[model samples]
Target: MKFRKKVDKVLGTSLAIIMGVMVINVLWQVFTRFVMGAPSSFTDELARYLMIWVGVLGAAYISGKRMHVAIDLLPSRLNKEGQTKLKTFVNWVIIIFCLAAFVIGGLRLVYITFTLRQSSPALQIPLAVVYSVIPVSGILIIYYKLSDIINKEL
Candidate 1:
C-alpha cells in the first residue's frame, strides 16, 4: 500500500510537471509565431514529444487507478466467485498483452530507432528517447495489474 501510494504520487507529480512544461512550451511557441513574427524551431518538436510522454504516462496513471473504460455487462451478471475469476483472467490477459505489445515491441522499436540514428528534425533528439515511455508505461501498467490481482477480494 505504501509503495502504491508512492508510485501514484510520483506518477501524478511527474505528469503535472510535464503538462506544465507542455503548456509553457505552447505559449512560447504561439508568442514566437504571432507576436514575434518568427516561429521557434524547437518548441513545436518539443511539444510534440512532450505530448507523447503525456499521453503514454497518462494511460499508465489511469490504469494504476483502475479508471480505464470497461464494458462490465458480463462481469456484472456473474456471481462473486465468477466475477473474481473473470477479473483475474482479464488481468492476466492485460499483463500478457502489455508485455508483448508494449514492452517487447516498444523495446524493439527503440532499438531500431537508435540503431538507425533516427532523431527529430527540429530538436535533434533521438526518437528512441521519445519512444522510451512505451516500455516504461507498460511496466507501470503491469505493476498495477499485478497489485490488483494480489490485493483482490476473494
Candidate 2:
C-alpha cells in the first residue's frame, strides 16, 4: 500500500511537470512561428512526444483515482451492493483489456521498433523509448484495479 501510494505521488508529480513543459513548449512554438518567423522543428516533435507520454501516464493516474470515462447509467440505477458488483465487473474487464491490448500489444510494438532502431523523424529519439509508456500505463492500471478489488472500494 505504501508502494502504491508512492507510485501515485511520483506519477502525479511527473504528469504535472509534463503538462507544464507541454504548455511552455507550445507557447514557445507559437512565439517562434509568429513573431520570430521561424519555428523550431524540434519543439513541435518534442511537444508531440511529451503529449503522448503525458496522456498515457495521466491515464494511469486517473485509473488509480478511478476516474476513467465510463457510462454509469446501469450502475447509477442500481443499489449499493449492485453498484459495487458492477464496479468490480467493470474493473475486471478493464484489467483484462489493458493486459491484452496495451501490455502485450505495446510490448510487441516496442520490441519491433527497438530491433529496427527506429527513431522519430524530427527528434531522432528512439521510438521504443517513446512507446514504452504503453506497457507502463497498462501495468499501473492493473495495479490500481487489483488494489480496488482487494480493498473492495469498487
* Winner by TM-score: 1
Task: State the C-alpha lDDT per candidate.
Answer: 0.94, 0.93
- TM-scores for the candidates: 0.96, 0.93
Models, CA RMSD each: 1.1, 1.3
lDDT of 1: 0.94
lDDT of 2 by residue, 111-135 (tens): 9999999999998989999999999
Query: Worst lDDT window (10 residues) for model 1?
Result: 145-154
Taking the tens digit of each residue's C-alpha lDDT, what string does model 1 give over 1-154? 8999999999999999999999999999999999999999999889988999999999999999988999999999999999999989999999999999899999999999999999999888899999999999999999999999999922
C-alpha positional error of residue 100 in candidate 1 after TM-score superposition, expressed in Å: 0.2
